[model samples]
Target: MSGTVALITGASSGIGEAAALSLASRGASVALVARRADRLAELADRIRGEGGVALVVEADVTSQEAAVAAVRRTVDELGRLDTLVNNAGVMLLGPVVDAPVEEWQRMVSVNVLGLLYTAHAALPHLLAAATNGRRKVADMVNVSSVAGRVARNGSGVYNATKHAVGAFSESLRQEVTGRYVRISLVEPGAVSTELADHNRPEILETIRQRFADVERLEADDVADTIAYIVTRPRHVAVNELLVRPTQQQA
Candidate 1:
């Protein structure tokens, strides 16, 4: 991974933040993209202090223009892009009957549409990375959830969005694997992050209580998996990784 460049969206916090630090630790120049400019600058400064390359691009990947600009900025500043982590997402879980329609739109826009916008802009760069050198490799890591794999009550739209992500990852993996571009999905069951805070207060409390007894997977856990995937030899491609806390059954 030395000398390679990776662009991670939603990098101000959660899995995206962890992945940025992990990639930097392994000698990859990282481009951090998120809406919070201050947070992005902080991360970039920290990485630079540690003698790793970092660039901050303030963007909301949900917008197509923002997504395209983010990609172009990474290439303009970093020379080339070798890996893209499509980790920007939102989680809004509520019963379909009474949930706010706006919430559903936000979730779909970020989780499904945002993923597409980012990936659509990044495909050319990723394919270029594959033919760039001896590694003959490039990576696209989509951060999904267990919700994507199993349908459950109270999470219909969230589940649908994640399922779309999984399907896209698989289909694109087939399209580009032989071309040396690897598309992978990291599905996490639960993690102690702000993902739940985006929900209604009562709902958030209820969900948090369910994990009160058992420690959930940390953002760093998923980040570590991402680092491991991109750090492997060119011949190695991890198709998918499912990470759930030992206490999680569903």
Candidate 2:
């Protein structure tokens, strides 16, 4: 990944942070995008301490303009954009009845719209990089969820958003794969991230009990999966990967 530049959104914590560190270790100059500047700075320092290049761009991906600017800044500062990780997302789980409308909006805004905004801004650069950059191939990895594959009680809206991500990733992959731009979807099940921390108290309790018996995955686990996808040879494209804990059934 030396001489290549990768941009990751939602990079302050969890899988995004892990992916940034992993990619940096592999020699890719990383651009870390998130709303938290402090966290981004800390991560960037850590990357630099390891003799890796990192750029911190603070922006909210849910806004189109901010998302576009984030991509532009990465290219302006890092020279090229070879990989984009559209990983900014939220999961708010609850039954439809009496559920907070704000929760649904939040899920859709971050999980779906935010992904779209980042993808839109990064596609042109990714295409150009695929044809002109060192690797000769560009990657776009969308961090979806296992909920994308199966709908469940109390997670209807979350399911819808993730399903939308899968659909968008597949459609975009078909449109760009012929051009050496690979699009991949990573579906993670029961990862120990802050995703579940946003739920209401009742929903949070339900989630805790449901996963009480199962040992969940760590952020680095999914980050490893993403790193594998992007680090593959130009001719190899791992389109969709579903990673679940050994104890997770759904």
Best by TM-score: 2
Per-residue C-alpha lDDT of model 2 across residues 1-250, encoded as one tens digit per residue: 8999999999999999999999999999999999999999999999999999999999999899999999999999999999999999898898899988998898899999999999999999999999998889999999999999999988999999999999999999999999999999999999999989988888899999999999999999999999999999999999999999999998
Q: Any idea what lDDT model 1 has? A: 0.92
Q: Compared with the true structure, what per-residue lDDT tens digits does model 1 show for residues 1-250?
A: 8878999999999999999999999999999999999999999999999999999999998999999999999999998999999999999887899789999999999999889999999999999988984468999999999998999888899999999999999999999999999999999999988888889988788787878887799999999999988877888999999999999998
How far off is residue 198 in model 1, in Å? 1.2
lDDT of 2 at 188: 98
Off by over 4 Å in 1: none
Q: Candidate 2's C-alpha lDDT?
A: 0.96
Clashing pairs in 1: none
> In model 2, what is the error at residue 195, expressed in angstroms?
1.0
- What local lDDT does model 2 show for residue 146? 98
TM-score of each: 0.98, 0.99
